[model samples]
Target: MLQSLVPLLVDGLANAALIFFVAVGLTLVFSVLRILNVAHGSFYSIGAYAAASIGLWIVSSGFSPYLTFPALLLSAALVAALFGPLVERTLVRWTYGKSEAVQILVTFGLFLILEDLQRMVFGVQSLYEDTPMALLGITEIGGIVYLNYQLLLIGLAAVVIIGLRLLIRHTRHGKFLAAVVADREVSQTLGIDTNRVFIMAFALGVFLAALGGALATPTSGVAPGLGAETVVLAFAVAAIGGLGQIEGAAIAAVIVGLARVLAIYYAPALDAVAPYLVMLVVLLIRPYGLFGSVTTRRI
Candidate 1:
């Protein structure tokens, strides 16, 4: 039992890391923009597609395989740079202060459009680019071989969590973000340039989502409906963690990931529903989530 549990734990942590990236981004966007972005998952699929295409090109061109590692980051950066400001400035800006229904509808429409666009561009077939995974090789834990890339993902997730905390607690931009989150009107009154802050926050969220997708591309195949699937799972994580809580999202991701791994190991039929089951139980116990609380919002 100990040997079997060790591998499960390792797999769970790796899965949690990927989920944390997208869930944290979703939570961050909600905390600052006050809008739940229904289209956020499109950025993830776009990043995966971009990274796979770029990585394949690099390999075909006979460039060093090590180049694929940087390509993942570059692909995510490119997606965020292209879509982040454009979508936030034009569409998302319009939804501010609107009803939640209106915001959801508008962003959902964008999600549909982006999904169709991806189909047209990348087609229905899945794209697989696993050079990075192959290059990293494998590691032995409890007599079970696991991808070294998976271990790297676990470490990367830790770095991101710490980095985000430092950015929020210590950096100037983080303070501006905190000010806005505390009171948007008050921040504006203080000449905080709330609009600029919104744009930056939204873009940062996009970068994180894109980075998650780009990193996943080396392990998973990129397909047409991946965005929709990812969005649902991400929403579950965000809800379980509380809509605006970064630390909550991280913890919730671990719970969901462990639930998933356990289900896969013991009862394969329950694998798909395990995360939602955990979410249901958590919500039943704490509707606001483990770290979430009700707060009055300024109109």
Candidate 2:
């Protein structure tokens, strides 16, 4: 029983790690910008594509294989830097005070444009870059062999959570973000440049999403329509965790991940809908989400 459970637990955590990264990023951006970005998942696919392309190039050029690990991070940073500020300044900023429907429509248009751009550049073929996974070797856990890279993912996710908590509690930028989140008008009145904050927060969100994609490239294929699929799952996660709640996102990711793993093991047909099922159940129980609370507006 222990042996049987170990593999399930490990797989669940591994799944949760990837989901958490993207979910947290989505929630973070929503918390700060109050905008639900439909195009966020495009950044994830772009990162995966970038990492795979760069890793492939490194191998072809006879560079040190160890460089592939760093390439993953570099890919995410580059995507965030390239698109984050540009999108925020041009498209996102315009929708600040607009209705949510307008925001969704505009971002959906952006998503469509990005999807086409990805197809044009990467073609329809799937890309795989797994040097990092290959280099890491394998380990035996509960009589089952597992990739060391999977364990590394679990560790990295934990690190990101802790780092975010520390940043929010101890850093100046984090304080600024908190203040803005608490009261945008007051923050602006206190001389905080909310525009700059918006850009930084959006970029950070892109980085997290891209990082999730880059990391997953070692274990999964990067293909056309991947962004759409991911965003749907991400939205389910965001809803289950409660939008704009980081801790909620983490817990929700874990719950969704476990649900998925269980479905894969016990009911293959339900694997695809596992996360959404979890979301539905959670929303039924607590409409505000696990960590979300309804806020009353001051008249």
**C-alpha lDDT score of every prediction, in listed order:** 0.93, 0.93
Alpha carbon deviation, residue 117, candidate 2 (Å): 0.5
Q: Which segments of model 2 are wrong by more than 4 Å?
A: 297-299
Best-fitting candidate, measured by lDDT?
A: 2
Instruction: Write out the backbone clash pairs for model 1.
Output: none
Write down the lDDT that model 1 would get: 0.93
**What value does the lDDT take at residue 146 in candidate 2?**
88
* Candidate 2: clashing residue pairs, number: 0
